[model samples]
Target: MAAEAKQTCYEGSSVQSFRFFLEHSGEHQAILQRVHDILPGEFKRIGAGKSSLDFLGVGSGGGELDVQMLTLLQSIFPAVPITADTVEGSSQLTDNFKALVAKTTNLQKIPFCWHIMKCEDYEKQVKAKGDMKKFDFIHMIQMIYYVDNLSTTIKFYHSLLKNNGRLMIINEAANGGWDILWKTYKKELCVDAITEYRSSGEILACLKSQGLKYEEHVIPNTFDITECFNPSSQTGQRLLNFMTATDNFYQSFTPEIRAGILDLLRNKCSTEKDGRVLFNSNLSCILVYA
Candidate 1:
């Protein structure tokens, strides 16, 4: 399991997996549609009688999701201006987001600020600023694994909310095929890492323990991994690296281990129907209140 000690897998493999998921896989689109269905009505209720909106996005990635969500918010209160503060850990992604913002004329109309740091770092900076504003809506999408303490991080974000403000979180659904694979891969790698795979169930449990009330939405999603069945295939290799959170997992791990992982993915995690291999890649969205 130990290819090299103190080395990280999240930087390369995980990021590439996300890129693949967003581009090739159908799940991102499905999830976005679901968000559109669920969020707009809720935002309408929240924005009732309000003059303007304040938004904070944690782990906003390349701002593609941010733009989609903020668009929905804009549609709700077309006349009101929205001020968004976003925190993203990757400088490359932040730059990409900035570039996207530069090209989009509509995005230019919304006031947006970027913090090229982790959520925790942004929290410290928020404190140091001495004049911090509460947000009407905070969204953390599929990036809680990087937080030092999940409960603490959620609490901190929740604390930064205005009265009746809401915090939205999205993650893999518990007991889903993707969740099972993440658990299996983490056990196989045996790495003591901060970016541990966490599902919505675990996160909601933490919220429940903290006595928070929230609404839950399930978004159905799927990914085609037919290429992954062939070990020599580039797509297969990259999928394996992403699944196991390691680079060159096929070369680094023993043949038996590789077979075990592949068998799990091919047989248990994916369903073959109509000559296509579809992987169950469902995700969940939890809306917590302050």
Candidate 2:
């Protein structure tokens, strides 16, 4: 009998692996830079004439990007109060976000409400409580793959938008490494509770299907995965674990499966340059207006 592969989501080590992935990959830096460039223009038109603004951060990991967006929003509307709500499934991440808020001097004036739960659970709670809070800005970054139903989740969030409000989503591009990874190994790697392995392409299609208008921007990024080829490297092992979304992937799966994944990641999903394996981590940002 074949042993079942364990999911990283259930392991405490997944957090460290995720942090390592973010540190090694250029995805975060590229998105941060893009956000800085785009938000000034985007915020200019949002919440005009409003005395206050409500911002929602769905699956906001650690709140670094959320804080950056909030800072930009505050700058655009200095006199207006902004209430920030964050939904994160990880307790450790929520605590890290709260700790960041405590240290940030500018965020002291802003009111923050933290929901330590998954987006589905949060939605269920909202329905159960009949919560009718509309948000001026809602941002979901690199987190859509965890959703149970893509279209339903999008429609649910879109319904929470106020007039002229915007919902921003950042996810991997269809032609990127993630798409290849998921498409190739979904049956072998993506099992148990994890199912949705979507990208920006699906998001755009969903928006169009619902007759919603949206603007899309591609953000080119890469992950230096040279270490992942090194079997003895702990960092490389962690990176592989994160990339595969499995805890100790090399140890969990059969050697044949491991070799196949490595080959695909090295040859198909990444390009080698100067002895470095750079995985295509290109992302897409979709902006949908209410």
Candidate 3:
């Protein structure tokens, strides 16, 4: 009998695996640092002539990046008060965000409205309110893969932007390791329940199809995957689970499939240097102007 396929990593409790991935992967740090450098110039184009600013964060896990963005906005428009709306599905992550906000004295000028629900539900709530609330800046980072309808969701968020507003999206680059993995093993690994993988290439195509104007920026990143080769390593197993979007991926699949995946991950998706396997996990940032 075949083994039963498990749920996607994000479908259940995913904070630990996600945290482990973030800690081990250089992707997040690279993206964050690049954003910090570029966002000030970008902020100048948004919220112009407005007395206040509104920011929205979709799938705002832990809120570390969100807070940094808010701080940057505050610096650029120091006198303009900011209102931030955070949408997150995980209670633990939401609590972490709230705790961070409570302790951060610098965020005093930005008032937060927390919505402990999925982005889909949050959209419904906003629409049901019968008030068209526009925002100055909205960011959806590393979280678009889970949305039910990518195009519709993108359009909905874009519609919520004020004139001269900016909608920023960051996703895995088309040439990145995640994209390569999904392209090769999607049939074998991806399940029907999840929108398993999406890349900036697809997003760019979607925007082009809709006649939307946008700017693209690529940030190169890498993560050490040498631990993933060790079968007994707990961290390795967790990384494998996140990479495959499967629970216990090291043990769940047949030995042949597991071996093949490991081989591909080592040889095809990563490079070897100094006895370490570094995975190419590049990211792309797309800025859509409204």
For each candidate in turn, the TM-score is 0.91, 0.94, 0.93
So what's the TM-score on candidate 3? 0.93
**Residue-wise lDDT of candidate 1 within 1-290, one digit each (tens)?**
10112232224445556576466566568778888888887898778888888999898877888888887888779899889898887776777788988887777888888888878888888889877788999998877766778988988899998877889998888877767776787766646443466788889899999999999999888878888888678887776665565667778689998888778887888889888788888888899987
lDDT of 2 by residue, 1-290 (tens): 00112431222656676776777786678999988877888888887788889999998888889988998898888899999999888788788889999998899999999988889888999999997789999999988877889999999999999999999999999878889988898897667545757878889999999999889888888878898889999988878877777667787789998999899999999999998999999999889999
**RMSD over all Cα atoms, model 2:** 3.2
Tens digits of per-residue lDDT, candidate 3, 210-244, equal 89999999988988889999988888888888788
Model 1 TM-score, 2 decimals: 0.91
Worst 10 residues of 1 by lDDT: 1-10
What is the overall TM-score of model 2 with all chains considered together? 0.94
RMSD, every candidate, angstroms: 3.1, 3.2, 3.4
Best by TM-score: 2
List clashing residue pairs in candidate 1.
none
TM-score-sorted candidate list, best first: 2, 3, 1
Per-model C-alpha lDDT, please? Answer: 0.78, 0.83, 0.82
| Count of clashes in candidate 2 | 0
Candidate 3 Cα misplacement greater than 4 A, ranges: 1-13
